[model samples]
Target: MKALRVLLLLSLVAGSGAAAEPAADTGREPFVFQSDRIDFDRERNLVAATGDVELAREGRILRADRIVLDRNTGIARADGNVTLIEPDGEVLFADSVELTDDLRDGFVEQFKARLGTGSRLAASSGQLQGGTRAELNQAVYSACEPCADDPSKAPVWQVKARRVTHDRVEQQVTYRDAVLEMWGVPVLYSPYLSHPDPDVTRKSGFLTPTVGHRSDLGVRIETPWFWNIGPDQDATFIPIVASQRGFIGAGEYRQLFDRGRLELSGSLATLDKKPKERARSGPRGHLRLKGESHAGDDWRLRGEFYRASDDGYLDLVGLDSSETLPSFAEAEGFFDRAYARVGVFDVQELRSGVSGDTSPLAGPELLYEWQDAPSPDGAGRRPAAGAALHRRREDENQRVTLEGGWRLERFTDGGHRLEVGAGLRGDFAHGDGAADDNNTRLLPQASAGWSYLLAGGMEDLQMTIEPRAQVVLGRNSADADEFPMEDNRAVEFEFDNLFALNRFPGLDGAETGQRIDYGVQTSLHGAGDWHVDAGIGQSQRRKANRDAPEDSGLDTAVSDIVGRVGLTAGEMTALGYRFRLDKDDLTARQTALDLSVNLDPLYFDARYARAVGVPDPQKPPGPAQDKEEREQVDVGLGSKLDANWSVLSRYRRDLDTGRSLLGGLGLKYEDECLLFEAAFEREYKVAGGDPDNRVSVRLVFRDLGSLPGTQGVLPGGRR
Candidate 1:
């Protein structure tokens, strides 16, 4: 035998004249062959190659131990260790195969293939058509990796079909009489099934269904359909059928553009009507629209609108749990040293006994702020102006404000720091209804502060301590009572806002009179990634402001002491605490604690909070008219039992009332090809009504639209 490697150009022509033309002119690639030994038979127009034969044409390659090609029939046959590589990176293996001259169409025995998505397919026999379609008999498909220790062992999950077809052009796989198996045991059978090819990211199809039981809604199943409307647009429709509640439908539509995106989501349902109802049935629904766009390089426009048919509709449908729905639109701009915004907003109250008409609608609010470049010595100044118009059924008001400020800081070589600042603000307001008056006021404010740092320790351990204090002085507004309070009704004095020049959150109110805020903070760093930090502070005023609310913690000449403490050890444990103590008795007025620990496969987290309301000094000292204390705690823990299994549990309780507010437990298993989840949740009080219990189960098969909770009622009966 002689080793022969030949490049043969074989073309099929319709006539003798066409055969005279070159293969390039026909727009088709000719076959090229290589072999250790080659033979040709002129009478039959056949070529036989043996021992490591290889053929290549148009980006497709075929290799075998022996191959025979017939020029008269444009067919090739190969036996023993046959392998074919397609243009799209798919590899097929068979014991024996027959294919067209171009290798675009083929038939294989004992076929096995490796797809682009790392999945595997095997069949007793396979037929390839037009290079884009494959039909198989007695096929098995799986995305799970086979056992490494024992090659013959079954995968975690697989699908077996009597017949299966894959169409590359349509990017889909269709199966007939398919049986889904787990660990080689058949669990489900379907007459017909289809899914998008692994290469497809999005397509039109019915997504996985959600099955659950709720006390109020009973047993429910939700099946959703997704539509790939276009390259940049899509929509999903979720229709739910409940054993006791009939039907409910929800949908979401989204579109994308070069600079922005828009989304719309809504749901509607009809239920039994009470006496004197205007319509045939009581209808409930909700709509939400959100959009954002870049108007230019420095400006953005954004808007969101939310509306519900009734106060309890969103809660009952597990859509939203907020007590108030708000709608707003705004345009914002950013510049080198300035910022501006224009916006409007409206709110609808959902709390029982609260009239929606009392909620104010604010529109045409304008704001502009600019800051000057800092001076060489670390000094800067900012000037701002704003205007707002507010209206409600009971009252109407308009306010305009102008403000300017400046500050400077200096540091000494000895670790001593100094800061100083001054500013002026003016407010003009016109009110009607509740406050029928016009008011104008000017406030001048100034502040100064100083601090020192001391640090020293070994390389493995370090410690630092810092003491700071600030004094602020401002002229009090004389006629503040003549104007209505719009945005400054609630005030909280905490460590975060202790040293601010103005403690009030809004311009409608201001902290006045001379005051001094002082505090000291310390930290320690040790080996093994250990660290600790603590800080404490207090505020002292020359005279108490009579207009301050009783529970503000700042109504007295000496305000509450606020502090925080934190500790951490590597990545395994962390603890943080914050508290406010009454000045007179040193009693805790408010406190919060948070702890988290991660220990190998197990993790835990907890949060606790408590607040004591201050008694109104002017309330004649009788029984309190409202609850004055609040306490709550939340705990969560989870464990990853193994690489593919996990459990999670959570509980929330009202410590003051010793009542469990909510509790939940969940178990999940996930692997390369499948995900399974089950959860149970209990709510002690829902919408101020009776308790509710729910259970949910979900299954997700890899490479399918089986998201866990994107469309249905999530854990705890919330979406």
Candidate 2:
């Protein structure tokens, strides 16, 4: 055997005398051939290579045990373990192959291909043409990896077809007489089927259809069509048919721009039978639109619009579960040391007895804040201002506010920290309609605080305790009673705002009179990644605030005590609790608890909340009065039975009434090539009427889209 390497150049024009020219001079890549043994017959224009033969041209490479080529005909034949590699990372293997010298057009026996997208295809024979198309007979396609322990074992899922065609230019695959198999067992058969190749990012097509059963809606099926309008925009239209109800139409459209994007989605339906409470049948629908854009280098604008045909329409169609719909538009600016914003908003009430007209419309609200750079001594000044207008059916109100503040901090060598601050604010307000009034007032406020940290611990255990105190003195607005509380309708006293110069959340309200807030926060860390943190605080005012409501928890001289506790053990377990206790009786007014645990195959989580309402001081207790006491609990549990199977369950109940609100159970199975899920849910309470039950199922094929019941078939669709 002779190891010979030859570079062959063949010109398209016969007898052009370019065979001896260099590959670059001829303007075409020459075929570089290698073999341990080679023979050539110049008269017949034939070349033969044997024993580890290899040929390379352009980016394509072919190798085999033996090869024969005809220069005049530009043909090549390879036998014994033939392999061809394409430029785009595709590898083809066959027992024997015959192709043009360029390798674009070929015929292979016992063909197998590994695609760039991690998919596999195999056929008894295949024909490659035009460098972009392949036709196969008796083919099988799958995305699953072969079993490592048992190489001959069947995949989890695969598609077998009598004839298969792949079009690289179009990025699509079409199959005839296709049969879907699971574990080598035929489960479904189709005369014709087609899908986009894995390389296709977007294409117009009909997505998977969803099927489900609901107690209120009966049996329903939804089929959606997606339109790939352009590179920057797309849309999906959904049409649903129900056995017991009317036909429903829904759609979503989205577009992207250089500086912004917009989206709109909605649904509409006309019932076949009108409800007994309505006089006539009418169409019900819901609409939502959202958009955002960059206005400048440091500014952005955003807006949202939402509407519904009726209160019960959303609930009946399972569109949304919100109790209110809100619409708003706003612009925000960000600077090095300043911030500004302007916005307008409105809300629509969806509750049964609530009137939308009662919801206030607020617009043309402006807020601005700026702060100076801190000096070497940690001292700075901040100025803030705001204005707003609110309108309702009964009245309209306008307000303007301005404030200035300064602060400084110092840390002592003895582990003591001190802080001081002061500010002055002015407020102007006017009201019309039911309450016609005008008022102006100037408010001055000041605050000081101190804290110290104490630490002690061993190598395995450490502890730290910090005790903090602050005193705030502020003068109330002289005409506080002349204006209504628009943004400060609900006031909560908690540890989060215990030490602030002004505890009120809105400009319409302010904390008045001198008060002292004190709290102690402590933490402990032990071996095995265990830790605990706790804090407790209370406020004491010099005198009761007449402007504060009785149930606000801050109207009395001694405010309610607020505190929280948290514990964690590594990444497996966590617990947190927050509570507000009445000052006089030390009874809990509000409490919230959360706990979660994760132990390998098992996981659990639970949440509980309770709040006690206070009676109106001006009204006597009676059976007709509304009770505000509320308590609820939610719990979830899950377990992984094995590598491919899992079960989950959830329950939510009203503790006060001992009634279940919602409960659900789910099961899932997933592997390398397939996923299947089924769920059952029972809703014990709904806005419109009686209890409801729903069952849904979903299946997904790897590298392919989902078979939908609740989940969407496209990328980023509903899940």
CA lDDT of every candidate: 0.81, 0.79
Model 2: per-residue lDDT, tens digit, 1-719? 67788877554212235533433354767788889988877777678899989888778889999988866666798999898988887788899989887788989899888887678888999999877889999999998888899978989898999999988888788899999999889999999988777666677766766666667677767777888899999998989776777788999999998889999999999866636644235888889999999987899899999998887677666667777889999998999988888889888777765667667787777778888788755555555555555555656777788878878888899989999888888887877753547777788888899999999999998999999999888874335577657676556666777776766678788778878999999999999999999999999988887777565678888889999999999999999999889999988887899999999799999999877663322233333333466688999999999999988888898887787888888888888777877777787863336787777666677656432343632211121
- lDDT digits (tens) for residues 593-690 of candidate 1: 99999997999999999887643222322236223777889999999999999898989998877888899888888888878778888888623556
Q: Per-prediction TM-score, please?
A: 0.91, 0.90
Off by over 4 Å in 1: 1-6, 11-25, 32-54, 272-281, 377-392, 434-436, 477-480, 614-627, 686-688, 707-719
Q: Considering every candidate listed, which one attains the maximal TM-score?
A: 1
Kindly give the stretch of ten consecutive residues in candidate 1 with the minimal lDDT sum: 614-623
What are the clash counts of all predictions, listed in order? 0, 0
